[model samples]
Each structure stands twice: as C-alpha cells, then as structure tokens.
Target chain A: MHTRTLAELGDALAAGEMSSEELTRHFLTRIEALDPRLNAFITVTGEAALEAARAADRERAAGRAGPLTGLPIAHKDIFCTDGFRTSCGSRMLDNFISPYDATVVRRLKSAGMVMLGKTNMDEFAMGSSNETSFYGPVRNPWDLDKVPGGSSGGSAAAVAARLTPAATGTDTGGSIRQPAALTGTTGLKPTYGRVSRYGMIAFASSLDQAGTITASACDAALLLEAMAGHDPRDSTSVDAPVERYADGLDRSLEGFRVGVVEEFFDEGLYPASAAAIETALDVLRSLGASVKRVSLPNLALSVPAYYVVAPAECSSNLSRFDGIRFGYRAENPRDLADLYKRSRGEGFGAEVKRRIMTGTYVLSAGYYDAYYLKAQRVRQLIAEDFRAAFAEVDLIAGPTAPTPAFDIGAKTDDPVTMYLNDIYTIGVNLAGLPGVSVPCGFADDLPVGLQLIANHFEEGRLLNVAHMFQQETEWHLRMPGGEFA
Target chain B: MALTRRQVESIANLARLQINEDEIPAYVRNLSRIIDFVDQLEGAGTEHVHPMAHPLNMSQPLRADEVTESDDRARFQANAAAVEAGLYLVPKVIE
Candidate 1:
C-alpha cells in the first residue's frame, strides 16, 4: 500500500478491491505514526478528508468517478483550503483559516480527490532548505539528519514517506524540484501561469507555479491533468488547453534531441552530481535520444538576478498582512506604527524579514534603476538565452543540485551558500519554462536527480521524457527504509 | 554596493522589523555578497526594454460587478490577536 502509485490505487479503488475511506485511513494512520519524526504536515484535515473519501466512494459506486476520483492527495500549506488553516508555514498565519479555496485545491476537490492534509514548507516560501519553516524543519525520510530540500520540502517528504500517495507543491526558485531531488521523489514545476495562482499565498508572484510531487512521472501526469487549467480568478492564469499528460507516457524517445548545457556541468557542480548526469545521459542515449552540448552563456547569472527580482516582488506581495486585514497582530501596541512594526517583526521569521528588508531597499526611491531595473533587464537576457538554446535542442538536461541532500544547518548561516543549491533549477524559472527533477542515481548514500527542462507549455513532453527514463530505471520505485511507519 | 551596518539598521527599520544589534554583522556580510552578485546586472544594459512584470500580456476578463463572495468576517477575524464586531482592533492613531 505504501509504494503503490496513484494510478494503481485508483485502479484498485475502481475494481472494488479498496475503498477511498480505507486508503485514506491507511495514510492517516501512517501520518499520525510518522509525522512527529518527519514534521511533514502543518495541519491534517482528517475529518474533512474522511468525509471527502466517503463521498468519493459513493461517487465511484455511481460510476461517475474521474481518473483521480477516490484518490488521496496532500496540499502544500501555501494553498488556501477553506476551513483548513493555511499557514504558509509562518507565525503570521499560524491561526488563520482560509475563507476560500485556492484554485488548485478547488479543482482537485472537484475532480473527486480526497484532501489528506496541508504539508509544511519554508516560511513564505523563502528558503532553499526546509529549515526556515516556522513549523520546524522537515527531515528527509531517507536520512533523518539531512534536510528534505525546501519551501516544498514537507510535500516532498510526505509523499516520499508514504504519508500521502501524491502531494501538491509550489515552486518559486526551485522550491519543488530541489526538495524532490533531495528526497528521491518526482516533482514538476509547470510553465509559469500553467497552473492558476488564485488563493495561493504569494511569495514571489511572477516566479511562483504549482505542480505535483509524487512517486512517478505517470502519477505527476495524472495530477497535472486535473490541476492544469485557466481560472478567471487568477489574472495570470494561462488560457491554453491542457494536454492529456498520462496518455503519452509510453511514447518512444527514439531520435529525441536532449541538450546538455555545458555551463551547468562546467563549474560549481559536485563530481558525483556530474557523474550521475553523465550516466543519465547514457541511459537516454541508449533509449535512442540524441544527446548534444548546448550553451546558455548568460545562465551563470541566474542566481544573482533571481535574488533581486524575487525579493522585490515578495516585499510588495507580503505588505498586505499589516495586522489590520488578516493573520497575526501584535499585542498592546501604542500606535498604528508600533502595531505594524511589532506585528510584522513578531509574525515573520528571520529569512522572510531579511528578504522583505532587502527588497524594500532595492526598490526604494534612489536605487530602483541600479538594482530592480537592471535585474529585470538581465532577466530578459536570461530568458533570451533559453529561447536561443531551445531552438537548437528539444529539452535541456543537468544535475538538479550541486550535490545530493546536504546536512541540516550546513549552509544555514550563509545565505549565499544556501542560494547556490538552486543554481541549476533557477534558470528555468527565470526563462518561464517548465522543468522537472527525476531520480537518476545515488551519490554518497543519497539520491541525486537529473533535471529535465522544456519550453513553455511543454509539460506533456517533459513528462513523456521523464516517463521514458523512469521506464528504464527503478529508482523512482525505491522507498526509504521504513515500513510506512 | 556593500551596505554599512548603519544602512542595514536603517533598512530594517524602514521595513518595520526589529533586528538585534549583534545579528547586524552577519546580515551585512551575507547581504553584501548577494548585492555584489546582483550588481553584475549593471553591465547588461537594459535601456529600452520594458520590464516584463508577468509572462503573459493579456488582461483578465472583467465580469459584472456583483458580490459573488459573502463576507466571512467572523471566520477571518477568528485568528486576529484582537478584534471587535467585524472590524480589526489596533492601536489608535491621530488621537
């Protein structure tokens, strides 16, 4: 039951071998038993989930179920689910229950999927490691001491530990992919606007995207099919038609053009990560992919540009929580200014405040052009670099991180070192393209990931490629040592 | 581009957050590295390019201005540290 994919569970549910209630109970029991050690969930919606599961069972009995009907899924804490506390992993929102559902949550519920719980994440989705989570750092199930890479770390860790079969994740600057890489799970960040952002707690609005982290590429495809669509509520939601992601899972990779970015491998990559990438390339070549070297010369500057642009946007987006509208407020304030100051000072964690301060500084009156405007210009150049490279290659490939899971607190003191963890994954976000992290091999007893990046709205192709590679390898099937606790 | 300790304190105050004096050195050092990294953008020369705020250029279609949403004032204010009726309570200003 722990290792079963969503498709298999759905088939079992359809065949009358298992009821959604039973599956939901099994996962709930597992979460209750293991979540203390993992800290993967912020809020577990047991009653609501069981109620949804029972309803799903009845719907399936009526023969009105969709592909995801009767399946259990967890949401990142960032997505607002009405009646459930959507904390965004911050003290500011610790007690705040959403009045409405995020678009993704609404769509998944409409598809008849059961909502298991809300998973933990970095406070306001700020950090690379899950360490910045105000709820406490989520541990990698593979190794209890190492981090499960972050912002989406709780979602990745939950799925990997079988606390949930599949979970929703949001990526702003590699939050989903990096955690997925470290936890030995599959995560996909669709093209910006491919999934609606309505009701999702904003971090950096321009770069944020919602996707899935599951056991397999096929599972990701199933969730993506249901989650990807335009919503009138989200102004930035793309109106393009979503493709049948799971329908083409068996597509042959023969004659597929896979481009390996030279800069990704040239500098700042760990030797083991480099070797795992090379080995994955060999696997792709064996499967009939024509591997070639491509260059995105300006790709090296992605981390720097992202720090400016993401923080600037975050500072603006987070200003709405000023102790007057919603969320936490300071006690016994002397005046409105003190109320604002003490509330924010107490509510937000260190990293979030650091980013807010940095953003406000850069976007201030005297420094806008030298910082914000210049960063945007560099952002264009980075986007153009991907545009030029994609013309020469169908998909880009590289190591997801410099190495596998680093120990917790190894890079905590140094923000620059922590930011470097997203070096390979950040470029895709800057270019507004789709990217995924699939388990390729293990380095130093930890799982390493091979990143697959495709052009905008190319999610189907990216999943197809990932499915082909997964078909030839069993890495995605390997579970961490534990009997589903 | 490196910020002095005084500048860091000023920025922190401007953002309405309180940081300990001892934490300033570490924050200054780390923020300086990141600022230096972003300073490279000065060479990119973005004179005429419009800042692309979003990926898409289309505007969201507007609907008739009807209230599709009901005010959940009670539920929303449940988490506030202090509240009265439907309004959020805070320290008075202009007294």
Candidate 2:
C-alpha cells in the first residue's frame, strides 16, 4: 500500500478497496516507524490527520468525491496551517499558531487531501542545506549520514521515504528541486505568481513561489492542479486559469526541442552527475526530442545576483517579526529598540541573521546602487538570456544541482560554498520560470536529477515532458535501501 | 573587500540584530566573504538594462475600497506575547 503512487491510492479509495482512514493510518504508521531516523517531520498531527481522513471517507460514501479525495500529503512548515504551528523551521515562528490557512493549504484541503503535519526546513527558508533548521537537519533517506538538500529538505525526504505520497514545498532558489534531486523525488516549482503566496511565510517575496515535492511526476501534476490558482488576498498571485496538469501528462515528446544548458556542465559540476544528465538527455533524444546546446551567458551571475536580491527582500519581509506582533519575544526589554534587537537576535538562526545583515548592508543608503540595483540589472540580463534560449527551444534541460547529496556537515562551514550549491537552480527563480527535477540516475550510489525548465505558465508542458521521461525509465521507481526500504 | 569589525557592527545595528561580542568576528568574516563573492557582478555589462523587480508584467491589482473581513483581532492575537484590552503591548516608546 505504501509503494502505490498517489494516483493508484486514489483509485483504490474510489474502488472501496481501502478507506481513507486506512490509507492515512498506513502512512502515519510509516512515519512513526521511520521518521525517527530521518527527522523529516517537524510536527506530526496524527489525531487531526485521522479526523480529516475519516471525514474524507464520509464524503466519498455520500457519492461526492474528487480525484484527490482522501489523498494524504504534508506541507512544508512555511505554509500557515490554521491552528497548527507553522514554524517555518525558525525559533522566531516556533510559537506561532496561525489564525488562518495559507491559500495553498486551503485549496488542498478543499480538494479533500489530508495533511499529515508540517515538515522541517532551513530556518525561514534561508539555507541550501537543512542544517540551518531550528529542529535539526533532515537526514537523506538514501544515506542517513548525507544531508538532504534544502530548505525544503523535510518535504523531499518525506516523499522520498514514501512517508507521504506528496508534500507541498516552496522554491526561492532550489529549495524544492535541489532537495528533491538529492532525495530522488519529483519536485516542481511553478512560474512565479502561478500559486497564491498568501499566508505562505515570505522569504523573498519576489523569488519565492510555492511548489510540490512528490514521488513521481504524475503525483506532482495531480497536486499542482489542486494547489495552483489566483487568490485575491495574495496580490502577486497571477489571475490566470490553472492548467489541467495531470490531463496533459501523457503528451508525447516527439519533435519537442530540448536545449541542454552549456553553462550548467561547467567544471563546478561533478563528472559522475554530468554523465547521469547526459544519459538522461539521450533518453529524451530517443523519445523523439531534438537536443541542442544552448547558453545562458549571464547564468554565472545568478548566485551573486540572487544573494543580493533574495536577502534584500527577506530583510524587509522579516522585519514584521519585531516582537511587537506575534512570534518570539525577549523575556525582558529595557526599551522598544532593545526589544526589537534582542528578540530578533535571540530568535533568528545564524544563517538567517547573516542574510538579514547582508540585505541591510546592500540596501543601505550608500551601497544601494552598487549592490541592490546592480544585482537587479544583472538579473534582467539573466532573464533576457533565458528568453533568448526559449525563443529557439521549447524547453531548457540541465542538472538540478551540481552534485548529489553531500555529508551532513560537509559544506555548512562555508556560507559561499553552501550558496554555490544553488547555482544551477537559482536562475529559474530569477526569471520566474516553471521548472521540475526528475530522478535521472545514480552517481556514487546517490540519485542525480535532470532538471527541466519551461517558459512562464507552461507547467503543463513541464510536467508532460517529465512524465514522458519517467515512463521511459525506472529511475523514479527506485527506492532507498536500508531500514526504511 | 573584507569588512572591518566596525562595519559589521554597523550593519548588524541597521538590521536590528544584536550580535554578542564573541559572534561579531565570525559575522565579519562570513559577511565579508559573501560580499567579496558577489563583487564579481561588477564586471557584468548591465548598462542601460532596466532593473527587473518582478518577473511578471502586470501592475498591482486594485480593488474597491470596502471592508471585507470580519473582526478577528482576538483570534489573531492568540499567539502574541503580550496584549491588553485589544492592544499589543510593547516596551514603552515614550516617557
């Protein structure tokens, strides 16, 4: 039952082979038995999940059920789940019990999906690895000693371990895709504004977009269809119609133009990972897609540009947590200024503070033109590069990350080294394009991912291409060996 | 391009984060490395390029001026650290 995909589980529920309650229990039991080793979940709402699952069963019995009815899923801690602690993996928000649900949470619940609980993430979605999480790092299921790429590490790890069929994640810069690649799960980041961000804790308002981490591309499509749409409350949410992503999953790749990003195969990429990506591209070519070398010349500037832009936005967004409102507050304060400083200092993790300080420095009066605006201009250049490539090709393909999962403590010491892990994935967020990472093959016995990027609002095409690739390969079906497996 | 300890303190003050004396040196080193890393952007030929603030081309959507939500201050303030008579309490700002 745990091995079944989300679609198969939905079918089983429809055919009355298993109740939603039973399915929910199966996953809850797995989480309890397995998550102690993985630490994937920050909070597990077993009682609430069972209640939601029972209700879903009643709805199905009453003959009013959606395709997603009773499907079990988890949300990254960033999304505000009403009455639950939406911690966002930060001590600042650990005590926060949201009064309302994020639009993503509301929409998924409306689709009859049951929430298992919130998964851990890098504190305030700031780090490339899960080590910065307030609750401690999530271990990759494939190799327990290896780090799960993050800030959506918990979600990706949970899905990879089959604790949940799918989970919701947000991507500002590879938070979803990088972790998914490391854990060998399917991850998707929709075009910016494609999903509502209201009540989804803001990290970098301009770059942050909510997406999915799932076991397979089909599961990602199913969840994305339910999660995508406009919300009046999130002014940035695009008012476009949500695509029938799952319906488009069976589309053929014949005549599809796939652009292999030349810059992505630089010296920074591990040779073994490159080999896996090249093999995946060959599979695409055999599927009747034409592959060509493409260059996003300014792509190398993505890391520097993103560091400035993301932190600048986060510094402003996180200013709201100043102890006057909800979130952690100091026990005693001499004055208002002390309250602000001490509360924030005591609350945010080191990585988050570093980002906030970087943002404050860059956006400071004297440095604004040289850092903030200059990075934004370079961002435009990077976007223009993607625009030019898309003009000649239907899709852009590359490695999701430079390499597979590293040892848990390997890159945490050096902030710049940690930041560079996101080099390949950040450009998609900068341009606000939709991208997906599908498990391609293994390197050093660890999963490598082939990333696919599509033009804005072309998630249907993105998922379709991924699903087609998944059909021709068994990589996505391979699960981790060891205790969990 | 390494930042001095004084500069790090000023930046921390501006961000409203109080770093303990022991942590300041580490912040100085890390922040300086980050700044130097991003300094490569200085070579990019971004002349005449518009600074892209957002990826979408749409302007802010406007709505009619009307009250839409019911009062839920009590519910919302459930997580607040301190409150009195429907007011959020903070360290006194004025004497």
Identify the leading candidate in terms of lDDT: 2
| Chain B structural similarity as TM-score, candidate 2 | 0.95
Docking class of 1: medium
Candidate 2 runs further than 4 Å off:
none
RMSD (Å) of each candidate, 1 decimal: 1.6, 0.7
Clashing pairs in 1: none
TM-score of each model, paired residue for residue: 0.97, 0.99
Chain A only, candidate 1, TM-score: 0.99
Report every candidate's CA lDDT.
Answer: 0.89, 0.94
Q: Report the lDDT of model 1 for residue A48.
A: 93
User: Could you give candidate 2's per-residue lDDT for residues A1-485 as a string of tens digits?
Assistant: 88888988999999999999999999999999999999999999999999999999999999999999999999999999999999999999889999999999999999999999999999999887899999999999999999989999999999999999989999999999999999999999999999999999999999999999988899989989998988999999999999898999988889999999999999999999999999999999999999999999998899999999999999999999898779999888999999999999999999999999999999999899999999999999999999999999999999999989999999988899999999999999999999999999999999999999999999999999999999999999999977777
Residue B24 error, candidate 1, Å? 3.2
- Those runs of model 1 whose alpha carbons end farther than 4 Å from true positions after fitting are A483-485, B45-50, B57-67
DockQ score of the complex predicted as candidate 1: 0.61
Q: Count the backbone clashes (under 3 Å) in each candidate.
A: 0, 0
